[model samples]
Target: MAYSDIQKTEFNRVTENLIEITWTYVNLLEEFPRLDEQDSMSWKQMFVAWANEFEELYGHTNWIESEKTYPEAVEEFAKEKILQWAGIRKYICVGKHIEGITLNPYEWLLEKGQDVKLFESEAEAKIYLKTNGYTDEDMEFLKFEEVWH
Candidate 1:
C-alpha cells in the first residue's frame, strides 16, 4: 500500500511523539556520579534497562506488540466464552465451521418421563438419601445410569 506525503508525515509525527521521551543520567556507566551537568538518553535506553529484567521481554514487548494487533485473537477467545455462557453453540470451532447441535440429556430424560437424580459421585447420593431418611431397602429397585456430559 502506498501512503501519501501528508499521511506519512502525520504518521511519523504520531510515532515520533509516542516514544519521544528523555532520561536524565549523571553518569550512565557509574552508579552515582556527581557532575556539573546531567546527560540525557532516549526512550530506547529506558526500554533496554527494563528489558534486562527478563530474557523474552524485549522481543515480545518491542517486536510483537508494535507489529501486530490482538483484536482477532481477542475476538476468537471471546467467542468461545460467549458460547459457553449461552450454554449452546451453532458452530463447534473457531474456524472451518462444523455444525453444533446441542442437546441436554437431563431435559431429554425429563421429556421421556424418566426420573433423573444427578449426583456427581456415589458418596454424594448416599449423603443425600441418608439425610432424606431413605432406608437401605428403599434403595432397592432403583437403577443407576452413567451419563456423560
Candidate 2:
C-alpha cells in the first residue's frame, strides 16, 4: 500500500539499541479495537513522538485528550518521544513519493548537518549514495527502500 493509504502504522528496529515503532493502530478501532488502558500506555510510551507528527500534519492541537486517564496523556507524550528517537528536530518536505522515515525531514536534516538526499526514484537515491561518499560496504547496511511500502 501507499503512505497516503495507510491510516496508522509504526517502524521499529529489531535491535535494542535502535528505536522500535510498531504500528498497532492501522485500522484504528476496527482490527484492534478497544485499546486497554495498559496497552494504550505502552503504545504511548513507544510511539509518542510519531503521534505528535499527526498533530503537526493536521495543524491543530489535540481536541480530544484524556485528562482523567494517564494512558491518554502517555500516548500523547509518546509522540514527542518518537521524534526524539528519530533524531528529528523538525519535519521537512521531501519528494512527493519519499516518505515514512522517522528521522528529521530532508531540509531539517540538511540544516542539522546531515547528508539529506531527496530523489525522484530509488535509483537516484542509490546514485547519490555512491557518488556522495558511500561505498558498496556502506550500502550493504543502509536500506534505501521506502519504509511505508
Candidate 3:
C-alpha cells in the first residue's frame, strides 16, 4: 500500500512548513542579535520574541505554544508526522519466475500463518533467503517491493 494522494500532499505541505519555519528561525537569529542572548531574556520572553518574529515574517500566527512552546511543538509535530508516515511502510520479497517457478519467499513464510519476517532492504532479504537454502540463482529472482498503507 502506498500513500494516498491527499496524504502525500499533506506530508509535502508539513515538510515544507517545517523547512520554512527552520529558515525563519535562522533568519531571525541572523537579523536580530538580541534574540540569541540567553542572559538578557527568560525562556518565555525568548519564545514570545520567536513567535513574534515568526508572525512578522510569515504573517501567520501559531497557537501550538499554548500547550508546549513553539519550538517544542514544532519539533514534536514534525517528529510525530514523520513517524506516522514512516509507520505505514511495509516491505516484502516478491519472487519472479526464473527457474520455471515463481518462488515467493515471503509467501512461503506467510503461508503458515505465523509471524512472517519483513525485510527493510533488498540486501537484507537476499541475505536471509540465501542463508536459508536459497541459492544465488534463486536470489536473482527476488525483488523487494515496498508497500505503504
Provide the clashing-pair count of each candidate structure: 0, 10, 1
Better of 2 and 3 by TM-score: 3
Question: TM-scores of the models, in the given order?
Answer: 0.23, 0.23, 0.33
TM-score of model number 1 = 0.23
> Residue 40: error of model 3 in Å?
37
What is the per-residue lDDT of model 1 for residues 71-110, given as tens digits with 9 covering 90 to 100?
3332333333323332433321111112322332212112
Model 2 spans > 4 angstroms off? 1-116, 147-149
The residue ranges of model 1 lying beyond 4 angstroms of the native Cα positions read 1-115
**Model 3 per-residue lDDT tens digits across residues 118-145:** 6766788777777889998866655566
lDDT scores of the candidates, listed in order: 0.35, 0.42, 0.50
Task: Pull out the clashing pairs in model 2.
Answer: 10-23, 11-21, 12-20, 12-21, 48-78, 48-79, 49-78, 49-79, 49-80, 49-82
Worst lDDT 10-window in candidate 3: 77-86
